[model samples]
Target: MKVTSHRDEIRVSRLLGASRYRVEKPFLSEGVIYGFFGATLGLLISFLLSLYFQGPLNRFFDPVKFIESDPFFYLSVAALEIIGGILVGYFSSWLSVRRFIKF
Candidate 1:
């Protein structure tokens, strides 16, 4: 939970024993560089899944009639996915950070 005044620094760690950790404080990009690299892996997984399943998903759902009948159903599903992703992402991020700080 220590935020250095100079942002380009961080504490790396190793677990020495149960409930004990050894920290090696170092100067770096304060994880900005590592953050981007790590973040992209998550995005790539999401993108690849969406891309590869585009066809199979349609076959499974068979929403063509609904789309033809009214576009609102499709739009509603899209909106729900967007809203759900935002909520899940926000809460998951918060939960992880809180756990890390507590640890």
Candidate 2:
């Protein structure tokens, strides 16, 4: 059994291709930078839009009245802001990768 196992191992190693070399640290660093830039841009854009639209939005939905009350309003606004930022960041990252990383 041991002899067969060793033979099988040798055969498998011979059939398989050599291991790939590791990527350099610089490549990984550049990718991180690229992702960070996209996320930052998305967050900024989302924040500005949220700020500009918040007042009008609140006014339009004023009849509900609860949105303007207390911590609920603040919490809702914060959640919206966070969701907007995340969506923007994802899209921006996708665009950056698509545009810059050509096949």
lDDT top scorer? 2
Query: Which pairs in model 1 have colliding backbones?
Result: none
Model 1, residue 61: displacement in angstroms?
A: 13
Q: Provide TM-scores for the models.
A: 0.36, 0.42
Tens-place lDDT per residue, model 1, 1-103, is 3233322322233233322122222212323334444555555676689999988888988866443457787567655655555555445544444454344
Each candidate's clash count: 0, 0
At residue 32, candidate 2 shows an lDDT of 49
Question: How well does model 2 score by local distance difference test?
Answer: 0.53
**lDDT of every model, 2 decimals:** 0.47, 0.53
Task: Please state the error at residue 92 of candidate 1 in Å.
Answer: 0.8
lDDT of 2 at 21: 15
